[model samples]
Target: MRPLQIGILNVMHDKAATNARFTKVLTHAGRPVALHFYYPKTHYPSGAPAEVAAILAPLDLAAAERMDGFVITGAPIEQLAFADVTYIAEVQALMAALAGRAVPQLYLCWGGMAALDYFYGIEKHLLPHKLFGVYRERRLAPAPLLAGLPDEFYAAHARYAEMDRGQIEADARLHLEATTASGELLLVDRPEANQTFMFAHLEYGREGLLHEYQREVTAHPERQYLRPAHYFTDPQTMSGPQFRWEETQHVFFDRWVDRVWAKREAKEVSA
Candidate 1:
């Protein structure tokens, strides 16, 4: 059997860790998946390391075409508009290339916003509450990408902006899958091409959330009002810290892998 060549377009703010987490989940599924990472552009004036920026500076359409599957992850920084970013043009070009292609893509957080904007021509707006912590999302409907998940599942999320449910409902092409406690759209899928655009971070563990919390505290201590203990109050589980986080990741990974593998099988048979 041929190994699945997964091309990951991971950008700044612990993107390396994000890709590593994702790879760990997919590989643990017992299938062969080769991962290729697209590092972020370095000279980005956004405080990202110059070394990392150099690897992504020359990122182009050619880099995207080499993968069977792709993932565009969240970035640490963003301006009001997509055009404001230094690599926006290149990223736009890359998205345009993927349109109508059979190659599946899973976009999380900012990438989800960008994908929606690219497909439907609408921008995301800042949400009043920065959704910063592990949260639960209830699956509204079943899709190939969410094949094995329960009606409600946990995904790590930390964002200050969001697009309303009305926006997604307005687009006939986008299928809304999951929603938050306040009825916010958390998962959307493009059924025609087997692509998923998730506003929540399903690729995170407790450790990931802890690292994120530290960054937030370091940047704006006032915002430190948000704490893991608030979400994971159970001392028994949350106390171990690292072990609990790893276990959390494993549970979600099992579900994610099953879903991906099923989709891969269906696509191959249909092909």
Candidate 2:
């Protein structure tokens, strides 16, 4: 069988790290994969190190259309209005183009919020404080992507904006798959469109949250930020960011890759 073609539209400042992280997750899908990384020309950061930028190709709709699966990685710009995002227009165009195709798409974090707003009318709202931590979410419904995941699974979240839960519950077009104890959205499925929206970071490394917290605190000494909850072995000492979710993370991505392959196979049969 030919390797599955997967496209990753990476918008984070640490381009190389994001690329390596996603590459590690998707490669565990039990099949060979050919990974492609893209960066929006209109919004690529100006000072990106030459070495990191070299790994990314300019976002091309034509190339994106041919992929068996596509991933839109999270950005740190959730505080801004979707319309205010510099590359919103281009991103919207890319998403619209993919809307009519069969390619299975995965939208993560801020990317998930963007898709929720663009595909549905559900908007993301700011939280009183940043929802940083490793949260345990329970399955709200059955989904191919949720297969093998335990009843309650832990995933990391580090964001200030959240999807409208009421809107998600009321919309017949969306399937609310999983949620935290406090009713935050974790996994949502648009089965009709073959798109999955993941509000947390299942792809984060063991110390991902620890590094993020340290970086934020160091970057903004005047700002007060809480240490990510349920993450460190000792929050006070900030040691051991226990990777309790590693198994579940691998299972979820494996199932996702299978779903994309299944869709491709079904389409081939019909054709």
lDDT of 1 by residue, 1-271 (tens): 7777777777647755766777777687677787777754433546546655543333445656655667788876543577676676666667776664656677778888887887787567887667766566677777545555566566667777887568788878889977776676677888576567877666775567667767778989775445553355564455444323244345544544455556578877997
Model 1 residue 38 distance off true place after TM-score fit, in angstroms = 0.6
Per-residue CA lDDT of candidate 2, range 58-175, in tens? 8899889989899998998999999999898888877876776767889999999999999898978999999999988888888668788777778888899998999999999999
lDDT of each: 0.66, 0.87
Which 10 successive residues of model 1 have the least lDDT summed? Answer: 239-248
Stretch of 10 with least lDDT, candidate 2: 44-53
Segments in model 2 whose C-alpha atoms lie over 4 Å from true places: 45-49
TM-score of each: 0.81, 0.96
Prediction 1 global C-alpha lDDT = 0.66
